[model samples]
Target: MNITISLKRRCEHVTEGTDEAGSGSLLNRIYTELYITEGQSEEVNTQHEKHIRVVLTNGVAGVGKTFSVQKFTLDWAEGLENQDVSLLILFSFRELNLIKDEQYSLLMLLHVFHPTLQKVTAEQLAVCKLLFIFDGLDESRLSLDFYNREVLSDVTQKSSVNVLLTNLIKGNLLPSALVWITSRPAAANQIPPEYVDRLTEVQGFTDAQKEEYFRRRFSDEDLSSRIISHIKTSRTLHIMCQIPVFCWITATVLDHMLTTDQRGELPKTLTDLYSHFLLVQTKRKKQKYDEGHETSPQELMEADREVLLKLGRLAFEHLEKGNIMFYQEDLEQCGLDVTEASVYSGVCTEIFKRECVIFQKTVYCFVHLSIQEFLAAVYMFHCYTNKNTKVLEDFQEKDWRYSRYSSDSSLDNFLRRAMQKSLKSENGHLDLFVRFLHGLSLETNQRLLRGLLGQTDNSPEIIQRAINNLKEMNSDKISPERSINVFHCLTEINDHSVHQEIQEFLKSENKIREETL
Candidate 1:
């Protein structure tokens, strides 16, 4: 069924500048454009049915792909949107992956995941219009052998998890089922193009929507306005604000900084932004602890630093294994007591969330994939600069331009090592970490990270070396997205000369990087 819904307009400060008479109509059009059909409905016969059976919604990390799907399903379930879509079954690939090793028929799979469905007969399910929402295909570890899997028509047929999914999507099993799969752009290829009837991207918020989000997030009008102005002033930060998660992070960080009378410049780069946020959270936690006890400020700061380091280590290690969620043992492995880790709810809790898994088991994961990557970079920086004192001492005395033969204390060696580690992953898994590593070499970002690390010398030189290493790497072999990420890494350095060099390099090579840049 073709579904369309109109939303009521809510008068607000951001919309005050627009035509008041046209606001209601504009809201109607927006909702219609967001959910209305863009193509003609396909024909159906006794044996065949068609109408965009498979819809693939793609987005980058933290762009709200899963949230959009959730909202859509919830609205449908509430009879507020897409009322014709009955039986909306939502499954996250993260949870689905846990059962990839287990053998189960499609009927059993549904029974195990949704027990209520067991009461419905197969004939009833076939007749009704069902929407299956599969979220986070990027997190799936199942080997989906779509090309090789044989078609199975029976729901009671047993097969590998991938085979079941492939057959279900291919119309061999439950052909009438309408499937909506949400994934990061990188993993959209797991399902071949032939299977997808419609592809849409969740582009996060628009400029006006961003303003609305800020107003809703911060109750203080003056503070929210200041933040809006601050974000508008910085091009890089403003561009990143297009993402919903980044907007939340900005609002949270600026709220604390503005009220506390921060003296330094606001964060312009991603690393600078996250570093400031981390420092603010740690300091806030320390202050709370200091108020109750006679603990010294230094001692509190030391404890906070230790907690952050342990969390960072956990983030880095689990990220390498492609694990966003962990168990109690994982916390213990990071030298963190469960109670101590739980107390980190204020500072790092956003990064590490505790949730119940199957069988009443509890699991912890970074709130978002990018958070894990960001903390991984922070861990790498902490390891080379703070934990290892010799590296900081050598940075002060050594001529880092030349390679060191004596030890790994050389900043150049450390920078090269970081690049190597990040570049080894072809999936571009380490793209953010690589970008943040370059950003960490900037003096401004280092200043923000100072509470967790020692003072640095010749950070600009290290940044230059890292940039050179990036340039030496083959970009043509990787996706254009990675190349754009490389450009973003250059911008994170926040150096005019480096920007100019990038412009020259692009000009000489006859290449135009991302238009947004």
Candidate 2:
């Protein structure tokens, strides 16, 4: 088989921004710019040379790095883009981790993954144009250990995968082959700066791309236009749309609510949006049952609430451990069977895809990381409002888990502890949760959750305390990004009057005294 034929793979759900040559994206230019070999005449080889040997693409989670890599590789293989590249070999570190300790010759590595390559000579590797695309260095469990690993020149030499990877990256193996690596910014640092020829960051979607996405997503022109206009009108929502995954979530929630003619205002805050989406999914499932004329085992609405709380607990516990992927055991611990869990497949997403990883068994995760965070917040809200301890039966102390109905003092204590924990959390993982806690305390959101959960009267004292905490956090010592997020969180729960009050207080001479409070 031809190398290009052997390499052909489908690109799935790739969006508009990857190929567009916009001036804002330096990353696109770096990838598209063609380079020729130094010794060849410009006429003969100018288009054939691959400019950068190693391009490091960095982005936050859910910014579509994997999608872009798949799209690029497929485009090349299909002769739609980068025709100079004769072969593309793609590997994800998540899959690579399974064989990290194994030793293999370069040929063996290719053959194991792509048996069709066996007919090709190992010598062809050195002469043929090859592109190595490594996705998700952040997911890799193996230590690259660039400093400690010994380099090997021979491609056929046996070594651990990381050593082989280090050698290949350092130009000790297949020095001329083009390599591309994708990682989260934090993980991108693992590769030495000297070894990388080009660095690019995928900043998700631009405003034009966001417009294009909605236009493509919704066939109803008026509805699509309305959604676009709504997103543009909300400054917070517009900023969130820059992330493709967040855009998908927003589109999903808005599309359903709009189409169904749901009453009340569209959700503005992250918590409100996620809650609306969950309710939409539940109503959808209820409609399916109504259409089927089938007798469901439990009340469709009641089951929805039950499943959400269970899933929220699962999300919270797993997030605490920094575990995004879950196995059967994890689901079992949450009192969920595969069949029962599948009911949440629409909203929670089946993160436990069996086909993608080395684990033959299925794994589960939230559709997006933010969903997990939102669900975690929901779990916290449910616990505080209802005094539900079933979710926290494993914990011995329940000091902070008091019901909001318990007493003013208890609710105040819980909010203080929660805010303190959120402010101190590394990476702001709990930021959304904190926001949700505040948002859920609102009379509007509480009314929305009325039957699904117990009532949590919004406390003026707690709100004031939380506002003060945010003001303190916005101090110079805190990161500007964190301060900005704090501002967003305050907007979600506080009254408009409070926003102006905080703004005035921030500018006042008493700012230091307010910060002390």
Candidate of highest TM-score? 1
Candidate 2 per-residue C-alpha lDDT over 204-313 given as tens digits, one digit per residue, 9 for 90 to 100: 88788888878877889999999999998776789888777788778878897677645668777777887666666555555642232222212443656766777888
RMSD of 1: 8.8
Clashes of 2: 4
TM-score of each: 0.77, 0.76
Relative to the true structure, how large is the alpha-carbon lDDT of every model?
0.67, 0.67
Per-residue lDDT of model 1, residues 1-517, tens digit only: 1121211111111111112112222222222112222331232111232467888787777776755664565456446788787677777787777778888888877777765566666667778888887888877878888797488888888988888899888888899898888888667778887677877778778888788778876788998999999999887878888887788778878887788645657777788888766656566555542233333323444656777777778887877676666678888999988876343555665455665545566666676676777777777777676545553343323443322344555555566565555556666777787778777777666655655655555455666776676666636775676667767777776644556776799886665455435
Steric clash pairs (candidate 2) = 35-49, 351-365, 352-363, 352-364
Q: lDDT at 127 for candidate 1?
A: 85
